[model samples]
Target chain A: MTELEFDYLRAYLKQRSGLALTPEKRYLVESRLTPVCRRFGLATLRDLVGTLKVARDSAIEKAVVEAMTTNETFFFRDRTPFDLFRDVLLPQAMARRAGQRRLRIWCAAASTGQEPYSLAILLQEAGVKLAGWQVEIVATDLSTEVIEKGKLGLYSHFEVQRGLPVQWLLKYFTQIGEQWQIAPSLRSMVDYRPLNLLNGFEALGTFDVIYCRNVLIYFDTPTKADILGRLADRLGPEGALLLGAAETVIGLTDRLSPNPQHRGLYGVAAPVVRAASPVAPPVSQLRVAAR
Target chain B: MTNDPAETRTCLVVDDSAVIRKVARRIIETLGFAVTEAEDGSDALLRCAEAMPDVILLDWNMPNVDGYAFLQALRQRPGGTGPKILFCTTENDVGAIARALRAGADEYIMKPFDRDILTAKLEQVGVVQADAA
Candidate 1:
C-alpha cells in the first residue's frame, strides 16, 4: 500500500469509526485490510482504497471499517471491574433507585457480548436483591459481525476458557460439539446492536451504568473528550461509568470524574463552579435543573 | 506446603505430557511459586504424600490412578483439602467439568492454555493475586 492509500484508509476509518490510527499503525491497516481486499476480490490495498474513494460499494466500506476496529474481549475480562459491579455498583444502584425498581446498563463497544453477558450472569447471581426488578442490558459494538455472533451467544472452547470462571461456565453454558453456547436466558438479557461511537446515542435512552472499556484508548484526544461528554449526557443522575483499567478521565474530559471510593469507576462530574461555591442554590433553581 | 524464608508458594504440575508440565512450570514460577512436576496422578500423589503443594494443576486423564481418582483420594488424606486443585484437561463437556468440581477441584483449565489463561485460572482460585498476573 502506498502512503496516499494508507492515509485515505486511515481518514476513512476515523470518520466511519472513532479509530484514530497513528502513522506507526500503517502496517496494522495494511495487514488487516489485505485479507479484506482478498475477501472482496480486490487486487491490493490500493485497489481497495480506490473503490472506497468512489463510495460505490457500501459493503466494502463496511468491511474495511469493521476490519480496523479491534474486538478483543473476554468474559469477566479484568476481574476487578466485575467485582466492583457486584460489590459496589449494584448495592448503590439498589439504594438510589429503589422506588423505580429498574436498572439499565449499557456496554458500549461490547465486542462479541462477553462483557454484557458477564454482567447478566452477575445479575442472575444477585437474584434476591434484583427480585421483581426490570433489568435491561444494552450491548453495542461497531462491528455487525461481532454483534450477530454475540446474539447467537455461541463461543469456541478456547473463547470460553478465557477469564470465565469454571462454575459459571458449567452453570450458564451448554457444550455443543466443541463450542459452548451461553444460556438463552443470559443471551436474551442483552440487547445487541451495531453502533459506532462517533455517532449519536440519544436514541438508546439513558442508562444507570455505562461500560465503555478499552474502546477509548483507540481514539484521539478530541474524540475522547467528545465521546466522554456525550456519555455523561446518557448517564442517569446516579449512573456510573466503568472504563478499562488502563484508561482514565484526568486528561480526557471534565464531563466525567473518577469515583473517589473506586479507582476505575467514574460518574458525571458536577459543575465545577457550582460544586466549589460555598453558598447553597435555592430550592426553585434545584427543581428547575432537575427537570 | 512448606515455604522458605522467601515465602514462595508451591505448585504441583501433573501431566503425562512433559511439554505441558514444562510450559506450566515456566508460567507458574513467574507468579512467585516454586513449581514441581510429576508425570501422572500416581506420581503426583506420591509428591503430595512427601510434602503437600499449595496448588495442584492436575491432568484429567492419566495412567495409574487418573485425575478424578487421585482427587477423591487427596480430599480424604490428612490436610489434603488444604491445596487448591485445578483440573486441567481437553474435556469441554459440562458433565465432566461438574464431576471434577464435585470431586473437589477448585477451578478448571482447558488444554492448549497460554500464560494468560493459566494466570487467569490461578487468580480465580485465589492461588495467585490478580496484580501478580
Candidate 2:
C-alpha cells in the first residue's frame, strides 16, 4: 500500500469505528483486511477501498469492522478481576441495592460471551447469598457474528479447557455432540446485544457494574476519553467500573478516578456520596495514586 | 469425592519419569491437594488401595502395567468411581484422547502444559479451590 492509501485506510478506520491505526500498523491492516478483500471478491486492497468509497454499504461495512476487531477472549480471564468481583464488588453492590433489591451488570465488548457467562456462573454459585435480589446481566459486543455465538452458549472442548473448571462444567453443561452447551438456566440470565461503542448508548440504561476492560486500548486517546465520559455518565452513583490492568483513567479523562482500596477499579468523578453503597470504601479515605 | 471439608484432598501422581512427577507435584500442591507419587501403574494401584486419591494424573506409557490396563482394573475396585482421572502424556492424537476417555479418564492433557493449563484442567475436572467460589 502507498503512503496515501495507508493514510486513507487509517483515517477511514478511525472515522468508522474510532480505531486508531498508525503508519507502523500498515502491515497489520494488510494482514487483517486481505481475507476480507478476498471474501468480498475484490482484486486488491485499493479495490476494496474504492468499493467502500463509491456507495454507503452497511453489509460490507459490518463485515469490514468485524474483520478488524479482535475478538480474542476466554472465561475468567486474568483471574484477579474476577476475584474482586466475587469478593469485593458483588458484596458492595448487593449492599447498595439491598433496599431496592435490583442490580444490573454490563459486560461491554463481551467477546464471544465468556466474560459474562463467567459472571453468571459466579453469581449462580452464590445463589443462596443473593436470594430475593433482582439480578440481570447484559452482555454486548461490536460483532454481530460474535453476538450470535454468545447467544448460542456452545463451546468446543478447547474453549471449555480455557479457564473453566470441571465442577462448573459438570454442574452447568450437558455434552451435545462434541461441544458442551451451557445450561439453559445460566444462559437465561444474560441478554446479549450488538453494541457499537461509537454509537449512542441511551437504551443501555444505568448499570451497577460495568466491565469495559481491554477494549479501550484499541481506540485513540480522544475516543477513549469520550467513551469513558459516556460510561461515567451511565454509572449509578455507587456503581463501580472495572478497566483492564493495562488501562487507567489518569490522563485519558478526569471524569473517573481509581478506587483507593481496589486496584484497576474506578469510580465516577465528583464527590461520591457515601449514603447508599456499603461496599464502597469511604471516599475521604481513598488513596489516590499520583499520576 | 470425599464430602468431609476437613480432609485435604489427595492426588496420586503416576509417571515413570522423575522430572514429570516433580513438575506435577509442584502444580498439584499449589492447588492445596496432598500429593502422592508412584513410579508406575502397579505402584499407583498399590498407593490408591491404601487410601483413595481424589484425583489421579496418570501417564499413558509406563512400565509394570500401562495406563489403560491399570485404569480398567482400578475401575473395578470399590470407590473407584470417586476419583477423577486425568491422562497426562505426550499423546496428542484424537484416538488416544478418546481411548483414555473411554477407559474412565475424566480429562486429558497433552504434554508441555503450563501452570495455568494445569490448574484449569484440574478445575475443569472439579479440583476447585474452596474459597475461590
Candidate 3:
C-alpha cells in the first residue's frame, strides 16, 4: 500500500475505533486488513481504500475495524482482579448497597464475555450474600462478531483450559461434543452489547464497578484520558474501577484516582469513607481457591 | 525429560506420543520444573516409585495400564496422592472428563496444547506459582 493510502487507513481507523496506529504499523494494517479485503471481494488494499474513498460499504468498514482490533481474552485472566473482586469489591458492595439491594457492573471491553462471565460466576459463588439482590452485568465490546459469540456462551475445550479452575469448569459449564457451554443461569446473568468506547454510554445509566482493562492501551493519550473521564462519570460515588495490570489513571486523568491499598484499582477522585472494606482472605485460602 | 537434581520442582510428562511428551516437557521446564518422561502408565508408575514427581502430566489411551487404571492405582499407593495429577488427552467427552476428575486427577488438559495452556494448567493445579507464569 502507498504511504498516502496507509495514512488514509490510519486516520480512518483512528476516527472510527480510536485505534492510534503509528507509521511503523503499516505492515499490521496490511496483514490484518488483507483478510477483510478477500472477504469483501476486494482484490487489494488499493481497491479496499478506493471503496472507502467512495460511498463506503458499512459491512466492509465494520470488517476493517474488527480486523484491526484484537479480541484475545480468557476466563479469569490476570487472576488478581478477580481475587480483588471476591476479597474486596464484593464485601464493600454488600455493605454499601445493603439497603438498595441492587448492584450493577459494567465491563467496558468485555472481549468474548469471559470477564463478565467470570464475574457472574463469582457472584454465583457469593451465594446468600446476593440471594435476593438484583444484579446487572453489562458487557460490551466493539466487535459485533464477539458480541454474538458472547451471547451464545459456548467455548472450546482449549479456550476453557485457560485460567479457568477445573471445579468451576465442571460446575459452571456443560460439555457438548468437543466444546463447553456456559450454564444458562450464568449466561443469563450478563447482558452483552456492541459498544464503541468513543461513543456515548449515558443511556446505560451508572455502574457500581467498571472494568475497562487492556482496551485503553491501544488508544492515544487524549483518547485514553477521554475514555477514563467518561468511565469516571459512569461510576457511582463509592464505586470502583479496575484497569489492566499495566494501565493506570495517573498522568492521564484527574477524574479518577488510584486506591492506595490496591495496585490497579481506581475510583472517583474523592475521599470516601471505606467503612465496608473487608480483610482479604488468607494467602493459603487463595492458593487453594486457585486450584 | 531429564532428571536435573539442581531443579527444585519435578514434572513427569507421561504420553505415548513422543512429540506430545517432548512439547509438554519443553513447556513445563520453562516454568522451573525438572522434567522426566514416561511412555505409558506402567512406566509412569515405575517413575513415581523411584522418586515421586511433584507433578504428573498423564495421558489417556496408553499401551498398557491406561490413565484411568494408573490414577486408581496411584491413589491407592501411600504417597500417590501427594503428586498433583493433570489428566491430558484428546478425549473431550464430558463424562470422561468428570470421571478423570473423580479419579483423583487434579486438573484436565486437552491435547494440542502450547506453552501458555500448559503453564495455565500447571498454575491452576499449584504446581507453578500463579504470578511466576
Candidate 4:
C-alpha cells in the first residue's frame, strides 16, 4: 500500500475505532483488509481506500470499523486476573458495598464477551448472597459484529475449550449441534453494546469496576490518556480499574492511582483541592504554653 | 466374546469443546458403544460418580480443571470400578503419550482423528469387539 493510502486507512481507523496503527502494523492492515478490498470488488487496496474516502454509505464505514477492531479474547484469559477477582476484588467489593443492594460492572472492550462471562461464572461459584444483589454487567466492544456474536452466546468447540473451566462449561453451556450456547441465566447477566471509545461516553453511566484490559496498547499516548480520563470520570469514588498485566497508568493519568494492595489494579484517586485553611500552632509551642 | 462390540460398554467423552465432544460421540457410537459427554474434568468426575463408564475418552487440555488432573482424581476413586481411559488430544508428543500411559491411560489418540483408526484402537484396548456389529 502507498504511504497516502496507509495514512488514509490509518487516519480513518483512528477516527472510527480508537486504534492508532503504527508504521510497523502496515502488514497487519494489508493482510486483514485485502479481503475487504476483494469483497468491495476493488482492483487494489488503493482503490478500496479511495472508495472508502468518498463512501457515504454507513454500512461501508461500519465494515471498516468492524474489520479494524481487534477481537482477541478467550475464556478466563490470563488466569491471574480472574483469580484475583475471585480471591480478592469481588470479596473486597462485596464487603465495601454491603450496605448497597446492587453492584454494577463494566467490561470495556469486552471483545466477544469472554471476560464478562468469566466474571459471571465466578460470581455464580461465589454463591447465593450475590443472587439478592441487583448485579448488572455491561460489556461493550468497538465491533458491532463481535457484540452481536457475544449476545448470541454461541462459541465453536475450540473457542470454549481455550480457557473455560470444565465444571462451569458443563453447567453454563449446552451443546447445540457443534456449538456451545451459554446458558440463558449466565447470558442474561451481561448486556453487550457497541461503543467507540473515541466518542463521548456520558451515556455509559458509572461503574464500580471497569475492566479495560489489553486495549490501550493499540492507541496513541494522547488517545490512551483521553480514554483513561473518561474511564476515571465514569468510575465511582471507590471503584477500581483493572488492566492487562502488561498495561499500567502510573505516569499517564493523575485521576487514577495504583492500588496499594494489588499490582496492575488502579483506583480513582481523590481529587486534589487547593483550598486554604488557617494553620494551627506547632505542637511544641502548644506544650510550652500549656506548662 | 471379550472383543465383541455388541457388549455395549459405555464410554465417556470429556472435552470443553462441544464440537470435539460431538465428533467423539459420533465416532464412539459408530464403533457400536454408548457414549456420554462432560465439558471438563470436574463434570466428568461427577458423571463418573453417578454411573461408572467402561472407558473414558479424555481430552488433555481444558480450562479450570484439566485432563491430567481428572485422570489422577479418577484413579483415586475407591471400589475399583475404574474405567479404562484413552487420552484423546491434539498434543501428540510420544513422550507425552508414554507419560499418559504411565499415568494409567490405556491408549492415546491424536486429534483430527480418523474414525476407523479410533475404532481399531478401541478394539485393541478391549473396550469393543473387533467383529461384533
**Candidate chain B TM-scores, in order:** 0.94, 0.92, 0.93, 0.89
Local distance difference test scores for all models: 0.90, 0.85, 0.90, 0.82
Q: What TM value does the first chain of each candidate achieve?
A: 0.93, 0.90, 0.92, 0.91
In the predicted model 2, the residue pairs found to clash are A165-B123, A165-B124, A166-B123, A166-B124
Candidate 2's TM-score: 0.74
> Cα deviation of A291 in candidate 2 (Å)?
44
User: Pairs clashing in candidate 1?
Assistant: none
Best of the two (2, 4) by TM-score: 2
- DockQ, in order, for the candidates? 0.73, 0.22, 0.57, 0.04
Query: Residue A71 of candidate 2: its Cα lDDT?
Result: 90
Tens-digit lDDT string for candidate 4 (A1-291):
899999999998888787889889999889888888777777788888888878787876787778877888978776667777888878888888889967889999898888999999988887786868988899998888898899989987567665664446566888776677898988999999888888888898988889999999888898999999999999988898999878889778999999887777999988888788979889999999999
User: Which digits, one per residue and each the tens of the lDDT, describe model 3 over residues A1-291?
Assistant: 999999999999999999999999998999999999999889999999999989658998899999999898999898888989999998998899999999999999988989999999999999987999999999999999999999999999889998898889999998887788999999999999889999998988999999989999899999999999999999999999999987999999888999999889998997555598688999999999999
**Candidate 2: where is the Cα deviation over 4 Å?**
A272-291, B1-57, B60-133
lDDT by residue for model 4 (B1-133), tens: 2545566678899999999889889888876678899999999989998889988999989987899889988898873246877788876444565677767777666676666556645655666654442
The sequence of per-residue lDDT tens digits that candidate 2 reaches over residues A4-114 is 777887888888888898768888889998898898888888987887889788887788778888898878886768879999899999988889998899999898999
Lowest summed lDDT window (length 10), candidate 1 chain A: A271-280
Clashing pairs in 4: B3-B129, B4-B129, B5-B129
Question: Which candidate number would show the highest TM-score if scored against the true structure?
Answer: 1
